[model samples]
Target: MVPTIEMTTTWERTCELDDLEPGWGEVALLGARQVALVRVGGEEVYAVDHHDPHTGAPVMARGIVGSRGDRPTIASPLHKQVYDLGTGACFTDASLALRTYRTRVVGGMIEVELDA
Candidate 1:
């Protein structure tokens, strides 16, 4: 597992827009940790910790993505746990949440922000 701090701040290229399939997520190693790169919607991508904070399992990537009152979040497949995409806070339980990384499109490539 890679440190959450490193993955959150480092920029890594996981895949291209056409390379990612909708409704699915891919795991990438960032500075010794595994992170989930998800294609939530059309041309929209998100990065989150592969591990589910609620179950302690690396399965957040397999979760579904949707919005809850304008907030983007992923629903864990293990226990149906919901987490905020921007802040990585568990919606169901504020205390439990996986870590999220900063994602953006730069020069037509999807990049994740890693720690400095």
Candidate 2:
């Protein structure tokens, strides 16, 4: 007998534009992965791991949304570790970095590309 193969896609639509407000963060559960989505400047959308790499806590969705220069960032509520929303690099720690996902707005909905 032949074994069946399974294929998984990277990009997935998690929520609509209206589901999340500008300058705020929201949690999107992509299967077993928890993603934190944020709408910056009322236009650009960014997605990162819901778990804060420093604290290992799943509270990034409740973290503060702000920017450093032109790059958007989220400060971990637990330890106040600032992370770049674009590259998921920790500003203060510099040794650790969060995981960032590719996000895009399509038809007023947000789509995140999960890494395999």
Per-residue lDDT of model 1, residues 21-53, tens digit only: 876878887778789988867778888899889
- Candidate 1: which stretches are off by over 4 Å? 1-9
Model 1 quality (TM-score): 0.81
Model 2 spans > 4 angstroms off: 1-9
**Largest lDDT belongs to which candidate?**
2
Give the TM-score of each candidate: 0.81, 0.89
Model 2: how far residue 16 lies from native, Å: 0.5
Worst 10 residues of 1 by lDDT: 2-11
lDDT score, candidate 1, position 79: 87
Give candidate 1's error at residue 91 in angstroms.
Answer: 1.2
